[model samples]
Target: MRKGRDSKCLGSIIFVLVFCFAISALPFASAIQRQKAKIEKHEFGELADGIALYTLTNRNGLEVQISNYGGAVVSVKTPDRAGRMADIVLGYDQPQSYADDTVFFGVLVGRYANRIAKGKFSLKGVEYQLAQNNPPNHLHGGVRGFNKVIWHPREVSRADGAALELSYVSKDGEEGYPGNLSVKVTYILTNANELRIEYSATTDKETIVNLTNHSYFNLAGAGSGSILQHVLRINASRFTPIDKTSIPTGELKMVKGTPFDFTRPTVIGSRIDQADEQLRFGKGYDHNFVLNKKGKELSFAAEVYEPKSGRVLEMWTTEPGVQLYTGNFLDNVHGKAGKFYNKRDAFCLEAQHFPDSPNKPSFPSPVLEPNQRYMQTTVYKFTVRGAGRGR
Candidate 1:
């Protein structure tokens, strides 16, 4: 009887311990599950119609908010080395404010992202004219480009990240381009702390297409201060010089010994005020650098570092050129959180084909044929510079 009682007690203790162990592990398991990617939808505001905003959050807690109105990236929250998060892209507080955004903010630019000389281009012996919104040259598609239109949005299922897919259809002769262009842009916030932009387009008629995101980034956080202190490096030896009207001169000028030389990490404002004609024309650094790439595969384009915040931004793209545009045109515009954005407050690294490609026969063609599909991918990866990694 005594032996049986001892055996029974041992069995009961084992059972109780097992149950306690399992109960203790529950919170840990729940935390692991919470680390998975997630997405949420919220009503932004009405433009001419109501619009929706989709927020994509990755495993690392990085968040990106995008809207179907112009497919704009409303905000991007990232953490610095100290693990404090802040919004790094510039934008207005309200969705309605984006409708009157002249600096482009974080919207998607399309049709012809950069410039077309004299607002005209010859395609297959036919001359086409476009809106001279920038005066003498067409800029960012036209008066009503992709940035000003609404897009269809849907959630895309992905195992590696949270994705938002936006689609738009441009009617034939819309924005003075001859095509019924169907475009799809996918914004994926990956688990690796990267915001990947995938662009694909198809057209029924032959037309010119160059699409890019115009996100003004201030790595130290938007509206906090000037981005002139940020360090920048571009993997390129040559750049396309622009004319007085901001149109490319059709020459791939060497960046060596010029203010455009960002082959090494350098302060953005170091040479911005130099007595160079190109800098004078742009009022700062606003030129396209021909990337040092061999093929159409995705390659490193540029990297930016903000020392104070220890934040780093690396860019990779399949495009042949990147247009670095300092916000020299921002004229004390009111922005989010009651902050005022002024000149040099932000910077943009737009991955795209060379400007004026439609007019410059020597440049890479931006034409898409009827049966061919246009595809482009650009990745903006965020990281932090560890201690002693300062430039």
Candidate 2:
């Protein structure tokens, strides 16, 4: 009878062990399903009425909500290593804050994105003067850029999953930028776990044009902490060194033996504190990297890998250069949940023609003439690998 009782006890132990394993597997399975769930898009308002919200969700259940107002990315929901969702891009949850924000959060900067030195550049024997919003230089479309004005929506469909097309028209002499430029920006959330932003524009007169979305990203989830620990990899052998005023000094320097070397992946804070002139000039890293990629077409520019959350952001763009800004001037702005955004709270990877390109004859020209289409596309794809498999 004792032997019989021993065998029964052994069987019960095995049954309990198998049950525990099965229970553990259930959470994993549920996580994957939640990540791959259907995406939903909801309309916030009419296109003619001003701004609207459109959300694109992924199969792994990542959702990116945007507004046609400034082609702004309102919120981005991605899964952490534990399958928990958090918004990683910095922006206001309310429309009022976005409408009255200090800096450009998630705006479609254009006509010219970055600054042009002294707010003037001679193009083809004609000198054109631009608005000097950034003191001695012009910045991000000059006061009334694509962000401040409301844009009309061209196409949007719930059937497209999470894709929408938004367009804007800038009249002549607006903000000192020449030409009546017509612009279009399309955002797509793909099943491959990527958010692609494609831009196209055409002008009626000769004018300088460079368009880019100003989206601040925080891989450890937005408002989590400083981005010093995130590993970064930029596909470039050289970078465009900047002057004290953050303007390109017309010098294309190699990244060999410098703190700017990102050929191999390294943490952002690895050399950010180095007492170098370039770092000091930027107050951090606000310089543009002249991509090693030959020809003026689409190429991979940079990548951000957050270890704790296992979230990766890969940036691919058709522009010739990519600027890496470490968010040095966030200025303790209070965001959602009263979270104060201090320095290094977010980072921006803006792809475009070199800054102050019009002034530097050695750099690529950003001028677009009549009958010519000015086109630039940049795609930011998010993928969660490692321990974050859907969950």
Candidate 3:
């Protein structure tokens, strides 16, 4: 009888201890589960037309500040391995500075990205002439492209993320393009730390369209000096070679045994100074990589890793090509927080159809008719490596 009573007492004690422990852990578990994705809207500033700028922030510690003036991404803050957030995209502090920016900065470029030879292209036997802003060629949409236009803003709801939808209509004969193009761009910030950009367009007339975002990214945090120490891996076995004018020669050259080969995770500075014809022409890397995928699917394009911050940025896109620009011409330009942006201060991974694709019939076609909708999706997924707590 005594043994039976002792056993019952021990059992009762064990149950009480376990119950107390579970009760103590309940609040912590609830706190974690309550950390859902969120969206916060705030006024960034006012443009010349008095239109207000806006910002979006999600629960994953990612924030993007944008302006309707040109649908520019003014700032992007992401967390490092230590959970410390820092701005990684280069831009100006004042909104008006972007309006006067000679460099593309963090804005959208369109109509045609790269260059069109002699500022001319023949579409259906009609020779369209564009502004020769780049001297001998038409560059980045002919002086005033979509990057220079204001877009109307609309807020969208996502059950698992936050979104901002922007729309603009490109007038016929504007920038020497033939069609009245209607464009829609959506920016989504997911709880998984993904910055997804989806682009869609429809044209009234048959014309060529190539669009991309020009965000100078430095994973070590913007204004933190050279990104040469960073590692890059582009999923391409071939690349487009450029000419003296930085226009593609309409040839896809193999990257094997060449300085342009990034088949593995290699440091950017490893062969940047190598004596190669292509390097001399670009003055650095200002070329496009032929992505290894069918043009229709969203697949991995490239990845960049910043060792200092242990931040990894993986790019996935449906576009057939990616332009890797090393900011070779960024000289003495002023950026945010009293920092001077110089050559190779940052890099751009512009996902799009190949450069000068309209002229290169051999390349993927950028032509869109009245009935066909042009759609492209690119995602910049950020994640931190190393031991630390993630928000």
Candidate 4:
């Protein structure tokens, strides 16, 4: 009877041990289940006109929060080397603050991504005037650009990823731009950890269009700290310098021997404060780099590395220029997690035509005539330093 009792006790102990192992494996199982590609739509509150906000998440854990109002990228969550995920873009946690967002955050910039000299541009022999939102010049579309309006979103699921296609029709004379512009922008989150932005537009009349995503990224995680130590590399040997009012001076200045040089990998803060005239004008590295392109195709534009987290971001685009704005204007602004964001907290790489291109005849024309299509593609690919397949 004692031997029989001993056998029963040994069976009970084995059962307990097996149960504990299964319990410990629950979290891992759940994570594995999440790795399958899927898209989820969450109710992200409403805009003034009852437009809804939505967030899309993929199976690989790439999450993109967006609002129909302005088609803004509210946030982007990506994983670092340790497989720990964090929001790497700067913005407000609550969607309401975005209604009056002045810094642009992750909004879609357009009609023109940069500035227009003195809010004036002559197109097709007609001088057009725009709102001087940036004081001496017209900045980012106008006083009420695409960032300040709602869009119609059509959700689509692809074989490898999911996409949110946002459409908007801007009536002629809106924001002083002459065109009934119908624009379609698709934001795709792929299983390969890529955030792809595809823009297309057609105008009923001749008009200028330069679209880009204004996302301030900090690979160390948003609002965690400054991105001063982030290593940056751009494939451009030339950059467009800005004047006192932050408008491009229409000259493609060589970046060699200047603080603007990023041809070789360099820390962002290494020469940011150097006694250079261009650096002083932008308060940092706020200039448009002329992308080196061999043909009219997508090519490597820039790469940023955060050593602390081993997070690396590679930008590929078909556009000819990329505006590198080093968060120079962010100051004392409250962001996600109740964190205060200051200057140099993040950086933006906006892929588009050169700034003030409408005024600079020598620059690539941003004009779209009747029956002509405007299309631009930009991809932000994320990876860890030692990730074999570039994530």
> In lDDT terms, which candidate is top?
1
lDDT of 2 by residue, 125-219 (tens): 87778888888888887877888777776545433346778888899888887778998888888777778887888989889899998889998
Task: Give, for candidate 4, the lowest lDDT window spanning 10 residues.
Answer: 38-47
TM-score to native of every candidate shown: 0.92, 0.86, 0.91, 0.89
Which candidate would rank higher by lDDT, 2 or 3?
3
Clashes of 3: 0
CA lDDT for candidate 1: 0.93
TM-score quality measure for candidate 2 = 0.86
- In model 2, the runs with Cα more than 4 Å from the true position are 1-49, 157-161, 387-391
How well is each residue in 15-84 modelled by candidate 1, as lDDT tens digits?
A: 9999999999998778767887989999887666658889999987899999988889989999988989
- In terms of TM-score, which candidate is stronger, 2 or 4? 4
Write one digit per residue (lDDT tens) for candidate 3, span 3-42. Answer: 9999999999999999999999998777656665555555
Error of 4 at 356 (Å): 0.9
> Which RMSD values do the candidates have, in order?
6.2, 6.1, 3.8, 7.2
> By the TM-score metric, which is better: model 1 or model 2?
1
Q: Report the candidate with higher lDDT, 1 versus 3.
A: 1
